[model samples]
Target: MSKIKISNAVKKYGSNTVISGLNLDIRDGELFTLLGPSGCGKTTLLRMIAGFNSIEGGDFYFNERRINDIDPSRRNIGMVFQNYAIFPHMTVRQNVEFGLKNRKIPKSQVTAEAQRFLKLMQIDQYADRLPENLSGGQQQRVALARALAIRPDVLLMDEPLSNLDAKLRLEMRQAIRDIQKEVGITTVYVTHDQEEAMSISDTIAVMKDGVIQHLGTPKDIYQRPRNLFVATFIGRTNVLEGEYRDGKLRLDQGYLLQNGMWDKIGDQPLKVSVRPEEIVIADGETGLRGTVLDSIYLGLNTHYIIRLSGGEKIELIQESTMEELIPAGTAVNLMVKKEKINLFTGDGSRNLLRGEAS
Candidate 1:
């Protein structure tokens, strides 16, 4: 395992800069994920670390050794592309052995190492089958086996599960995490799927427009987002615009939020982000009043769309337990969980609840 460091790394095409000056440090044996939407520079950053793209500026280091000038072949990094990249003409065993063979290990040791990883990837039963005969998951496993056969210093994956069906993607993601842990390799994964990154990564960097917006553990990123974008991007949130004045938040609908609410906020107009599951709805005279606009029954939860008295719309998710669904046009009282609410200034740059003890 190697500690990868990138300082002020920059990538540009002609005069257009795709990756601005960025700095990051990935620890040894850590499963770090770069997560963002399309064209957000996640893949570009991964490619730079893989030595596939030239670094226009800044330093790239592996284990304290400068590797900016090192070739991709000499970097000893294992890359699993989105397409799996399995050789079609070879059997599974042959494909896995290809990397070891290219490195010119002893013929006896090559087969042993290849077989070890094949079994590790749990595709040993189909070792003799060709790629054409394998399913998508099997092909992905073969690709992983091949990448690990060489025992690389770092493993980089580019949305490796995006091609598989939903069930297969889940299965393979778990398998990938298991294999990575068993081998104890430092891995960098790139994906746009928030849930997938949260499920597998030791650390995640949420990027936008060639820069990192948030960096934290999955729980930190999800439960206490630092900014409005991170809160909305990582999960479902209802952002309400309100005015803060003299220890009270006056909603546009004329509701005065005073007691039993988080009011220790700056004296400014701000937006409140409440997760759908954290908002409570019930039959009560107290709490903010709203009219249910719509309700959809999902298998695990029932989602409701409610319009506040001030005409602002918000969503609430309740666990599916009761048989009768709360129909639209029903008047309901809403209360946001005090600890679960996140406050952001009007510009949406900072979370006001960060320093306060919940």
Candidate 2:
């Protein structure tokens, strides 16, 4: 196991900056994920760590040793790419043992090690099958086995399961986490899939505009987002436009909300974020009173779109399997949980709910 440290990292192309003054410490043997949208510099940072992209500034360290000048081969890091880089002519066992062959390990020991990881990846049954003959899930297992065959200090995966179908993605996610834990390898995964990162990672780093907005556990990143981009991007959210008037929050349509506790926010126009799951839609709730515009049933739950009296749209999720449901144009009470309310300024930088009890 090895801890990875990125110190004051900066990456630039010509005059364009990709990453700016980033600092993070990844604990040994923990699954840390870099999560963001396209062009957010996540892949750039990952490539820098893999020595595929040279850093314009800052140092990269593995444990106590700095590897800025070290070659990629000497970094002792394993990487699995999005495209399963399996050779068409090679069988599953042969592909998994390719790294061992390059290092010129004994033939007998190589087979033994390949079998070991094949079993670990649960692909030992497909050892003799060619890449073309195996399923997508099976091929991914072989790719993982190939990476793990060399037993590198850290494993880096770049959207390895993105190509798989939905059901296969879920299965692969579990398999990846299971093998990662079984091997106890320090892993860093880069993906734009928030659900994937949240489901498998010990901690996630949320990035935007080439800068890290926040880095914390999955729950912290999801439930208590630091900025507007993160709050809106991580999941479905309801952003209410309001201003603090004498400490009380008032919506755009003269509707007032109790905010005597929000002292730090003296009198600023604040945009509050509430998840669809946080707002309670019942018969006589406070806050925004809205009329249902549409309600769509989704297997285990139903989603409701509310057109607020202030003309703002709010989403509500109900887990009930009740067939008798609310319809369009029906008025429903909207109540946002004070504990789940995430308040931010118009710029979406300041977290107004930081000091208050919830």
Candidate 3:
């Protein structure tokens, strides 16, 4: 197990800077996931850690030693790719043993190690099958087994489950998590899938435009995103534009976000996120009167899109089989607590609402 650290690391391609002086510490024996949309430079960061990509500036350390100059093979970092990178000509056992053989490890020790991980990954039964003879999931298991056979200190995965079906992806997630726990190797996984990262990671770093926006537990990133970009990117968010005026908030359409606890600033335009589940849709209340424009039935929740008095739309979610199902075009009430409303300044950095979760 190892602690991987990146301090002010910068990577440039041509004149474009893909990553700029980023700093992060991945704890020892923990599964840390880098999550973001495509072209966010998540994969580039992963490659830099594995020594597959050079660090043009700053330093990367494995434990206490600086490894910016260490070769990929000597760094003792194992990498698994998006595609099942198994040799089609080699059997599962041969594939797993290939790395050890190249390093001139004892044949007996290599065989034992290969067999051990093949069983651990549950691919021992197909040890003799060629890559094409095995299923996609099985091939991935072989790739994982191969990567783990050498028992590297750090395991790096770049969207390893992207090629598999959804069901297989779920299975691989559990398998990967379980294997990492059993072996206790420090792991860094990269993926664009939020659910996948939130499921298996001990910690997550959400990146945007080659920078780390927020690094925390899945719950932290989802519940208390630091910025509007994070709140809208990491999960679902209903953005409401409003202005703070006289201890109250006026929406785009003149509907007030009433709050008894907060001191409203005078005429400060702000964007607030009202999570769908936090907004309660009900009938017979004079709360922001709106006409229901659409009712979207999500398996366990129904989402109602309502047009307020000033023709602005607000969405709210009702529990499964809500007894008060108002038809579209019917009048409804949108009730949201003040705390659930997240207020952000125009620049999306500083939060205008004091003492509120970021």
Candidate 4:
């Protein structure tokens, strides 16, 4: 395993600067994920680390060694491409053995090492099968085995599960995490899928347009997002515009913030984000009044779209444990858990609820 340090890294194509002066440090044996939408330069950064792309400026280091000019083949990194780039003519064992042979390992040890990773990836039985004959998931396993057979210093994956079916994606993600833990290789994963990154990453860097918007654990990113973009992009949230006054937040829809909900006080407009599950649909006449606009049954939960008296829409997710459904057009009182709300400046420059709890 190796620690990756990128300082003031820049990538440009002529006049277009895709990544601008980015700095990051990935710990040894850590599974770090670069997550963002398309065109956000997450993949660009990953490729730069793998030596597939050149850095316009700045230093890229593995441990204490500077590898800015090293060739990709000599970088000692194993990369798993999105398409599972396995040789169609080579059988699973042969494909895994190719890298060992390229490094000129003895013929006797090549088969043993190849079989080891193949078994680790649970594809030992299919070692003799060609890539064309295997399923997509199986093919992906072969790709992983081949990458691991080299016992690289770092492992890089670029949306490795994007090609599989949904169920297969889940299975492969678990398998990948297990294999990565067992091998303890420093991994850098790039993906646009938020759930995938949250599930498998030790640390996640949410990027946008070429900049990192937020970097933290999955729980921190989801529950205490630092900006409106991070809050909305990471998960489903209800953002209500309101004003901070004295010590309370006064919503435009007439819902006043409970006392001591936040520590800071300002008189500027702010946005409050409440997760769907954090909202409670009150039974009596104690909360803000709203009418149910829509209700969707999703097996595990019932999602309701509630339009407040001021015509603002808020979604509430109710667990289906009781199986009681509220019909549309029904009047309801909505109350949000004050402590669970996230407050951000209207321009999304700061998070007011960053370190304070109710």
Candidate 5:
């Protein structure tokens, strides 16, 4: 296994820079994920680590060894592509054994290693089947088995589950997590799916335009996003306008909230990020008044769309109750979980909370 470290990484296409002076450290045996939208440089960064793309500047290391100029084949790394790139004419066993043989392992040892990984991936039953005869999930298993067969020091997967069905994606993600833990290999996973990154990673780096916006555990990124882009990207949130003055925040709908920003001098326009689950039906008249526009029952919770008196719409999630649903046009007062909601300046660039990162 290897602990990968990258510092001042730069990737440029002529005058256009994709990645600039990026630094990342992935712990040994940990599943670290690079997550972002398409064209955000997640895959570019992955290819750089794999040595497929030349590093324009900076350093790449695998446990004290600089690999910027090392040929990809000599990096001692295994890669799984988005498409199952297994050999079409090869049987499952043959595909898994191909890597072992290429490494010049003894034929006897190669066979033993192939069988071990086949059983470990639970694809031993399909060992004799050709690629065309296997299901997508099974084919993915074969690809995984082949990658792991060589006992690589680092494993890199780029959108490994994108082509699978939703159910298969869930199942395969769990399977990958289990196998990675069992093998204890340092892994770098790249994906654009927020939920997948949240469920599968030990640490997540939320990227934008080749820069990492936030780096932390899944819960930390979700609950305390560094800025407005991350707050809106990681999940659903309602952005509401308010004004901060004299330690009190006045919402557009006339609801006043007392805050602890005692050092402020003059009134400042505020942008607040309130997640659906953090807003609830107020118990009294002191909350923002709104009229429900719609409600949808979703078993455990009911989602409500309300139009505030100021004409802005916001969503709220409430626990389902045995009583009848709140019909549209009903007047309601809303309250937010002050500690859970995020507050930003009017431009939505930096968070107002002192400890929250930008």
Candidate 6:
């Protein structure tokens, strides 16, 4: 029942607008993420949904009801912030019970509800510990438990794992994903980490300068981005210039890629996005020629830096084999996976592929 629909939303600080005429649809029981770099206004949009920021322009709805005028407290939202906001003065149990008490839940019911979420978050053993006594990860668990103890209609998380260490961040992200699926709450998570968003979100809206450049599932955005910026931002991609004419593209490295899909387009310059894994070593001399500049051998894969004949440096990842590594200065020919690569327009504004978003 908590599906959220935002229509032509806008936010401005005085005359400078941050979010301009944005629209988003968040399905019920889905973990949706607003992902972008710092100062991209992802947080600004989250606050708008929480009713903390004033709507300078459009309609905000929760299912059939309008919530633009609703108070933050009355909107029925649970928020977990960057810093573990649990009170130092209260024990974990008290922190979880705080919201229930504020809503005038009976004392006995509050205790039971708090106990339930503590168990759900796997923090029941630390229920009596004050915030100061628990580790950062445990403290975050308490914060999550407290937020869900109220059983709000929607959950909003803003960089909740930023304070945790590398290992704990991974652990906590998995825990959060599991808990969200169990509770089936319509949640909106905001984060700057691309990997974190890709791993946990049902849908992602990649924002830049307050505008959502792409909105789709992780696979769609990563595999076939709508534009050049999105293809580069969502993951590591090698950008190479090319010219398209007669249903074929002449890569800068002197390789020709032909596809019937390009028949409708006129001859023009192109920017190609090829992921590291999308380029493979070809037999004989039937592909783009390059020289290996260096190779870093990881356990399962070896990452190689290559300088193409056209003088462009690119990285490619190949699965490790029993044979010895290809040393630097070795000449190699590479071929791109035609179906996996993306071709953007000359200005990088739009993609020429048919399946991409318009």
| Best-fitting candidate, scored by lDDT | 6
Q: How do the predictions measure up, each by TM-score?
A: 0.96, 0.95, 0.91, 0.97, 0.95, 0.96
lDDT of 6 at 283: 87
**lDDT for each candidate structure:** 0.90, 0.88, 0.86, 0.90, 0.91, 0.93
Tell me how many residue pairs clash in candidate 5.
0
In order of listing, the candidates' clash counts read 1, 0, 1, 0, 0, 0
Candidate order (lDDT): 6, 5, 4, 1, 2, 3
Q: Which stretches of model 3 miss by more than 4 angstroms?
A: 252-267, 322-326, 352-358
For model 3, residues 268-347, the per-residue Cα lDDT tens digits are 77888778788776566546678888888878888888887876677788787847567888877666766767778866
For model 6, what is the alpha-carbon lDDT of residue 31? Answer: 99
Per-residue error (Å), model 5, residue 185: 0.9
Candidate 2 least-lDDT 10 residues: 349-358
For model 1, where is the 10-residue window of minimal lDDT?
257-266
Arranged by TM-score with the best first, the candidates are: 4, 6, 1, 2, 5, 3
lDDT of candidate 5 at residue 49, scale 0 to 100: 92
**What is candidate 1's local distance difference test score?**
0.90
Model 5 scores worst on lDDT over the 10 consecutive residues at 258-267
Q: Write the per-residue lDDT of candidate 4 for residues 1-358, one digit (tens) a residue.
A: 7999999999999999998889999999999999999999999999999999988999999999899999999999999999999999999889999999999999989989998999999999998889999999999999999999999999999999999999999999999989899999999999999999999999999999899999899999998987899899998999888888877778746678765746555677888888999998888877678999899999999899999888889999988767568888899998888888888988877788776451
In model 4, the worst 10-residue window by lDDT is 258-267
- Write the residue-wise lDDT of candidate 1 on 178-278 in tens digits: 88899999999999999999999999999999999888899999988889999999979999897788888776466666644555665799888889999
Counting only residues 3 or more apart in sequence or on different chains, how many pairs clash (N, Cα, C under 3 Å) in candidate 1?
Answer: 1
lDDT-best of 3 and 5:
5
User: Could you give candidate 6's per-residue lDDT for residues 179-297 as a string of tens digits?
Assistant: 99999999999999999999999999999999999899999889878888888888789999999877789996568998877777679999989999999988897898999999999
Query: What TM-score would candidate 3 get against the native?
Result: 0.91
lDDT of 5 at 230: 88
Better-scoring candidate (TM-score), 3 or 5: 5
lDDT of 2 by residue, 212-325 (tens): 888889898788888888899898899888788786877746766775557667788888888999877766655568899998888888899989987888889979675678
Off by over 4 Å in 5: 259-267, 354-358
